[model samples]
Target: MNMSSNMLSGPKDTTRTILVIDDDSNFLNPLKMSLEEEGYNVITAENPKSGWESMEKHEPDILLVDWELPEMKGTQFIKLLRENKDHNARYVIMVTGHSTTDYIVQGLDAGADDYLIKPFAIQELMARIRVGIRIRELEKKIKEEIKKLTVLEMALSVADKIGNPISAAKLHLQLLMEQETVKKSPELVESLTSLFSMLEEALELISKYQKIKEPHSVPAPGGKTMIAPE
Candidate 1:
């Protein structure tokens, strides 16, 4: 592979990271400068090896790779990169001289999100980068929402796990407080019985949640509804 190690870099910051893989110094150096000026942390690699490492290390949200590379082609790199679950969501745009229909299809089939031809204007590239930024932000937002939903579901599950028992104990206590016999009974005996019953009730509630039940589904008007076993 006639790969060059002439890497031009920028300081890391809160800006979005972009990995550009191309064996051409003519393209790599200029692209890096343009991207850096636009407030993006750019990682450039002349070979697929260093590109892959930078990808895994930097976790770039956008990729601008040439179709032709040293030993490994752009499609090959993307094929291998997509296999790793961690990089499946990367926004890839091919930058090469090959703009044929077949090559574009092949690149897209290999998991590239978009493509660009060589000798393209810097302004156009900037516009595409902006689009990539928007897309990455949307993906980040969706993931955060999913995380919040998971936390809410967990909280509800926990409440469900403990809600019934606490309520039952409270009702029991109210009954005991209102009853004359229980209120007048030896304070020590009443306290011991009440505490023991509450604990037993809580254990029973927890066990109920632990038991596995067969799910039953019924066809609704528009969808299927699941009924939990009682």
Candidate 2:
């Protein structure tokens, strides 16, 4: 198996990377050039072994895999890629000479996002690639939105747990400050006033979290989410 890469020379539409795995050099080289011309970073691997290595190294967003590889069948290669968590999220398009319905079903069942019969038009292939790119982008965006919502849910839960106790404490402190004994000692009164102020600030922070319509957060140390202040 051989590996080659075509790095974009100048500014391009996007830095989306594509990996092509096919043992036929004649087919692989032209496909690499066509993809590069379409403003994609293209990596070519002549067999599944080199393809897997390239996948590990580059983590390309889209993959163009031939149905038959030197080391293993294309469907088997796709299965292996799908089983690995790191590479499973990629958009895989299986390219093969097989046009039978069963073959297409097998490829899709093996985790291919799309399939193209051999001798396909370059324009059709490009169109398919564009669709794959859009799908990948949408999936990424949805995952980020879910993460944000999860963080917001956690924040609201924390606020709910702490809000009641803080409110009760403030109420008791207010009642105690109104008593004759508490009013008589000026130093103690000052300390209690400061404590009340601190409690009020905590309540205000919790209120902010409770009223959050959209939560923005960052990953903090120790695998925690820290909500960004408005």
Best by lDDT: 2
Steric clash pairs (candidate 1): none
Write the residue-wise lDDT of candidate 1 on 167-224 in tens digits. 6776776666677776576885578576867767775655554452432334556675
TM-score of every prediction relative to native: 0.71, 0.86
Candidate 2 structure quality by residue, lDDT tens digits, 44-80: 9998999999999998989999998997999999999
- Model 2: weakest 10-residue lDDT segment is 1-10
RMSD of each: 11.2, 4.5
Model 2 misplaced stretches (Cα beyond 4 Å) = 1-12, 216-230
Cα lDDT over the full model 2: 0.88
Number of the top TM-score candidate: 2
